[model samples]
Target: MDIVLQQMHYCLTDDASNWLVIAISALLVVLWYERKRIKEAIKQDKTH
Candidate 1:
């Protein structure tokens, strides 16, 4: 019983860390995409 509890705890923490990494990656991608859009907009304004 004790071993099972320990394993369960470890799995939960591991899953939590994976989720954190995924969330950070998603945020970075979103930021990068927004930056690209802003740069394009700036270039268009310069043309006008």
Candidate 2:
């Protein structure tokens, strides 16, 4: 019983870490896309 509980705890920790990594990656993607859009807008403004 103790070993099973330990295993479960380990699995939970691993899943939590994986979720954290995924969230960070998604945030970075959004930031990168926003930055690109801002840059384009600036370029357009300069042209006008």
Candidate 3:
């Protein structure tokens, strides 16, 4: 029973880490997209 509890704890922790990584990755992607858009707007302003 003790071993089973330990195994369950480990599994839950692993899943939590996976979710955290995915959330961070999604945030990074959004930041990158926004950065690119801002750069393009700056370039357009410079042209005018």
RMSD after CA superposition, every candidate = 0.6, 0.5, 0.9
In model 1, the runs with Cα more than 4 Å from the true position are none
Query: Candidate 2, after superposition: displacement of residue 13 in Å?
Result: 0.5
lDDT of 3 at 8: 100
Q: Tell me the number of clashing residue pairs for each predicted model.
A: 0, 0, 0
lDDT of 1 by residue, 1-48 (tens): 999999999999999999999999999999999999999999999999
Query: Mind sharing the TM-score for model 3?
Result: 0.87
Deviation in Å, model 3, residue 2 alpha carbon: 1.2
Model 2 deviation from native, Cα RMSD in Å:
0.5
Per-residue alpha-carbon lDDT of candidate 3 for residues 1-48, written as tens digits (9 for 90 to 100): 999999999999999999999999999999999999999999999999
Tell me how candidate 2 scores on lDDT.
Answer: 1.00
CA deviation > 4 Å runs, candidate 3:
none
